[model samples]
Target: MNVEKFKKDHNEILALVAELRTITQAGIAKNADAIAQQIRTMSSVIKLHLAAEDRVLYPALAKSQNPAVAKVGERFQQEMGGIAAAYMEFAGKWTIGSKVSSNPEGFKEEANNLFKALHERIQKENQELYPLADQI
Candidate 1:
């Protein structure tokens, strides 16, 4: 199952999430450039990570004997698509050098929603899905 690789990826994502949370909070408090850079970095890392999973882990999990686990993996993939769309939408809205202060509340709301969902997904993967994958 390569639990070490999964753990490493999980930790990296967690660190990125922390950075993202700081950047978004700073943006809400009037620092747009930092937020923009963080968003760009996060977007790249996330896309790459998802691509790796879709290319490797998902196919392996789907072919496993456990129907319940495979179904969960499929559902996770769908949820990941939704998260990716949300990230892209937020990235589009908050371009570099844009005036975040002009619409701080809206930006903050979107960032919060995105982070909350991401955090929940990460928790689930770390606590439930990854271990299950290891067992399988």
Candidate 2:
């Protein structure tokens, strides 16, 4: 019934994304260290958020008597696995400041794509998933 924690995590994730966007707008070469550090920070938050969802949220929804809700949960869980994997790869690849510094353009392109994916996922979770959970 209480979905505040997940909502808060979503807010934090979005805020970190906004900060990353702002840092990269000035260009990654000059902000490599900051970018890498921000990524690391976001990684920590994301790891915790995902862990919480896995431990508490998904299982509950999957067991729900409401078939529609269970289906949505299963779909979200399956979809998130890919997004999470991509994010882990992206975070691992760019966590080093030197890596970001060496290939700012590549980092920018990859980051743009990854961030877009994250944004879409978060929006769906907030608009669709959480509301379903609230109903349950």
Candidate 3:
């Protein structure tokens, strides 16, 4: 069974999120070495995804010349700032081992919160942004 590339990529990204959540929940002493590395890798993948979405979709939608679409595009950009800030905070903090590994439970809670926010952002992009892009 050959999965579509985007679908495969999306699934892998979600899986990585879950894996990080699991690792953090397992206690950092046992997984300390791996946590930062995994988060770094995930951050890179996420940036790529976001950049691609920005390149192909956001600009396209914004420049659509349709009043409704342009409005949506503007709102989308504004809304994304919150999501982006949250992600950046998570990514930057987790890159420092001491911050993430210092208190495993605390780290897990923060990670889960960020992951939940990311999941909602992705769902919004897929549901509203992607379709808006397609509409144009």
Candidate 4:
């Protein structure tokens, strides 16, 4: 397996998160089309990434007997579900365009929480779980 590919994906996700922060901040300042585009791009990227992990990575990791590995896989699945739901909610609000930007504070808050949780989970998987899986 190409661990570098996983690392690259991780970096891409971080970059997207950074873009999201900027977009949300801009939205809070005023209604910005760029924010809407960023949200759309983020939604697409996140869904693709999660699908790839679910199809290619998680199943492999779940095959392991190690309790730590199994636990990580379970946690990842749970987090992915939460992320998917949050993405849907964000998309719905964002589709409302100006209305979403008008009250960007709440949207930004939720986005921040989701981003932080995802970051932590990704970091744990990359630093700990992935390495162990590679050994298998």
| Alpha-carbon lDDT of model 3 | 0.74
Measured by lDDT, the strongest candidate is: 2
Instruction: Estimate, for each residue in 19-99, the C-alpha lDDT of model 2 and write its tens digit.
Output: 999999988999999999999999999999999999989998998989999999999999999999999999999999999
Candidate 1 wrong stretches, greater than 4 Å: 24-29
Error of 3 at 114 (Å): 1.0
How does candidate 1 fare on TM-score? 0.85
Candidate 1 vs candidate 2, TM-score winner: 2
Q: Which sequence of candidate numbers ranks them by lDDT, best first?
A: 2, 1, 3, 4
- The weakest ten consecutive residues by lDDT in model 1 span 23-32
Number of the candidate with higher TM-score, 1 or 4: 1
Every model's TM-score: 0.85, 0.98, 0.83, 0.81
Badly placed stretches (over 4 Å) of model 2 are none
| Superposed model 3: Cα runs more than 4 Å off | 1-9
Model 1 Cα RMSD, 1 decimal: 2.1
**Collision pairs in model 1:** none
Clash counts per candidate, in order, are 0, 0, 0, 0
Candidate 4: which pairs clash?
none
Per-residue accuracy of model 4 over 1-136 as CA lDDT, tens digit each? 4466677778887898797677666545465567777778877777777778788778877787787877787777777787678768867677555756677677677767777877887898788867876865
- Per-residue lDDT value at 120 in model 2: 97
Model 3: pairs clashing at backbone N, Cα or C within 3 Å: none
Candidate 4 matches the true fold with a TM-score of 0.81
Which of candidates 1 and 2 reaches a greater lDDT? 2
